[model samples]
Target: MPEIAPLLGETLTSPTAFHAPLHAPHEEDQWWRSSVIYQVYPRSFRDSNGDGTGDLPGITGELARLAELSIDAVWLSPFYTSPQRDGGYDVADYCDVDPRFGTLDDFDALVGRADELGIRVIVDLVPNHCSSDHALFQSALAAPAGSPERAMFIFRDGRGEDGSIPPNNWQSHFGGPAWTRTAAADGAPGQWYLHLFDSSQPDFDWDNPAVRAEFERVLRFWLDRGVGGFRVDVAHALIKAEGLPDWGGRADGGSTEGFPGWEAPMFGQDEVHAIYRRWRAILAEYDGERILCAEASIDPLPRLTDWVRADEMHQAFNFAYLHHPWNAHALRDVISSSLTAFDAVAAPTTWVLSNHDVVRHTSRFGLTDGTPRGGDGIGHGDPQPDLHTGLARARAASLAMFALPGGIYLYQGEELGLPDHTSMPDDARQDPTFARTGGERIGRDGCRVPLPWRADQPSSGFGGADSTAAPWLPQPEGWAGFARDVQAADPDSTLSLYRTALQLRRDLRLGAGSLSWSRPFEQSDVVAFLNGEVLVVLNMGEFAAPLPPGTVIAASTPGAVEDGLLVPDACVWILSTAG
Candidate 1:
């Protein structure tokens, strides 16, 4: 381990350092273009009522902590009414809060508190599907074939004799056939409905005008309640090809190879653009320049940029950059391609590493073999990660991400350098993917563990000091070391690193600046870029490298720079002292 050292002396020691006023602020209308938004998985954030599950009141209480981090907005995952068969993604009531999370009043309080802190709130909008228990879906089940209620969803006659087989070879994202056969009054096989994800989540028939009009009302309902925007869930899969054609590719959803040259009939259809244009116009009618962000995963890289046209979404998640290997050349290629692609559509690219869905980047970077193992759950039998090495690379990667000229999304607990609970017991897994795949694929439960707040408190202070049940997910025994209270006291802790980096990012307006590669290190393992007067260098090689010409400002890892040499798996920020 590198010897820890004080970073900024007295400035870091002061409690108010993170609360310092921003040196430059952009207009409110264009905030999404260069903002740092934090994503909160509500169930795992904090349990205020001591029910093991986090609620809106808990998130409301943490607005001050987010404000101190200089976050421009908070993007909350779904907390709407649901049976939770698919972790709340299967929404039964789009306009109401689930009792497991809190009442509608609690949501209003959270939005109100966030506004006072100058942080906007963005809620997840799962438009592509809803829970089978949803009122409309339930009514459709009872109605006869071809009824108007049944038209709201993708219900069709199966292809086999007695209508037994699925409509097509489409496979659910979880596993198994995408079409589920419904039962008639006498329990005979009836019409089949399409659900690209879990069977509990039936896809809406966007072709229906009623579905389109209903979503318009849903958008306005939240916009009127003061949410700054919506993160469109499965944005690309909302529109299927004409005639609901059969997929000629693999059953597991065709490979991403030959992406721009070939397109998937099930996803990223051209018709999807029209829907976003209409939604964008709806957002324009609201005050405060509301925005829309697509969670689309289109491939061939550049084709993903189509979702962010000027009249469409304000931004789209850059999955290409997130999934790139931890190689210098690979990272550079993705970064260059992302900036170029989004620039063509006049949209600012969004950068993200970890979220509730995938393995935390700390663990992902730690794998020596670099096998893609954690997209599903990482079980006890799986190869373990070297967390020590992972933390070093994760810190370095974060610095590189912040130096880019676009918006940033930070997953909860990443600032404390938390890794996925790779060894989580198999029986404790809750993701539907696990049950659907019958243990063949372990699920996303490892990354969804509750966060640690205080080192000494029960459940790592996630449930507060009050009496209650255990956390929804069991926290690792070593989590006490990564607690917020523990890291806040150590000047060299990852928490301090994030606090200092975010503060500098806001003060320098780095997000609004342009990026240019450092010519000398361009062909080497060093990723060195100049963002205006600031120079950011990330050394991904095994050997030490000489420092670029500048005055050192901040380093990602303590002791990253020694005798003017930067060690491997580290990053540093330097300011041009010579004009």
Candidate 2:
């Protein structure tokens, strides 16, 4: 390891230093282009009512913490009325908050508070599906096959002579058959409904004008409530292929593949663009720079950019970049491809390290090098990660992400370098994937454990000290070391690293700009790139590398630089005044 040194002094010691506005803010309407949005999974963020579940009020209470982190916005995961079948993604009502999360008034308060703190609010919009218990789905079950109610969802007659077979061989993204047969009003078996995800989340028929108009109303309802934008869940899946053709392959559902079946007949269809175009028009009707961001995993890479056309979504999460191994060459390849592709469509590329659906990057990076995708396969019994090495790379990766052009997303607890609670008990798992896969896959529950706010407080300060309720998901025993309070006090903690990186991201004017790779280093594992005047150098190899010729402005790891040497699994920002 290289010798560590303090790069900045008193500025970092003060809490208010991070809140200072950027030296130059981007254009108002183009805020989404280079914004740093933080994603908060409501169930695990904080519990205000002592119900062991997080709520809107809990998120509202943390606005100051977010504002202090220097993030531009917060993208909250679903808090909509649901049956808890797939977290909150299985929306029972689009316009209402789940009673478990809080009331509509609480949501309104959260939005208001976030706005006051200069942090925009972006709610998750699960437009592709709704809970089976939704009034519309219930009505569709009671109504006849040809009834208009049934037309709202993708309902079709079974194929066999006795109509005993599923409508098609399509499999659920979670696991098992995608089609579920419903009993008719008279109690006889009826048509089958398609659900690409969990059975409780029945897929909507986007071709249906009613479905289109209903979501339009949903968007307006939130927009009227002052939400700045939306994160479109499964954005590439709103429009399936017209004929609902078979994928002509095994029923593995591509669940095991790197692309996660994104190119199948059931996802990423060309018609999806039309739906977004209509949504863009509705968003235009609202003021205050409302935007749409797609959670797309579309393949060929460029297809993800299609959802971000000028009149459609403003940004789409770069899953390709997220899935890349911690290799300098691989990271550079994806970054170049994403920038070129999105630039061609005049859309900003959004970079993300971790989210609710995937294993936390800290844990993911800890594993030995391999092509691992999705969050289902690894868990408590899996091989433990090299936490020391993983965290170093995670910090380095975050700096690299912030140095890139366009927007970025920070998942909750990632700032603390929280790893997946890989030892979580199987009985404690609640993800639909776990139940559906019969414990064959562990699911994403490990990463959803409640965050640690204070080291010694009950529920790790996730809930108030007097509150007796346990966290919905148990915190790992090692969480105390990563507690927000602890990290806040320690200047060298990952939490502090994120604070410094985010502050420097704006102070250096790194977000809104074009990017170009600097000349190669002696080591192939070293990646150096220029974001305006800031030369970002990242060493992913095991040995030290020489830093570019410039003044070191920021470093991801504490000992990232010594005697002009860049240490392994580290990143540094250099101010190239002579360039």
lDDT of each candidate versus the true structure: 0.85, 0.82
Candidate 2 per-residue C-alpha lDDT over 1-579 given as tens digits, one digit per residue, 9 for 90 to 100: 644332332222222322222123235437888899999999999888787899889999988988878899999999988989889899999899889999999998998898789999999999999999999999988888799999999999999897989977888878899999888567788789999889999999999999998998899999989999899998878888878887754343344444355547777788889989988888898887899999877777877777888888898999888888988888878887888788787777789989898888988888865637467746766778888988988999998889888899999999999988888888888999999989887888888899988888888889877778888888888887898999999989898988988998878767787566654442367776666667777888777776545577778877988767788889988775422
**lDDT score, candidate 2:** 0.82
Error of 2 at 268 (Å): 1.7
Residue 538 accuracy (lDDT) in model 1 = 89
lDDT for each residue of candidate 1 in 193-289, tens digit (9 for 90 to 100): 9999999999999989899999999999999999999999989888888888777564434464443323566788898899999999999998887
Candidate 2 segments exceeding 4 Å error: 1-29, 185-187, 249-263, 369-373
Model 1 lDDT on a 0 to 1 scale: 0.85
Highest-lDDT candidate:
1
In model 2, pairs of residues that clash are 380-422
Against the true structure, what is each candidate's TM-score?
A: 0.94, 0.93
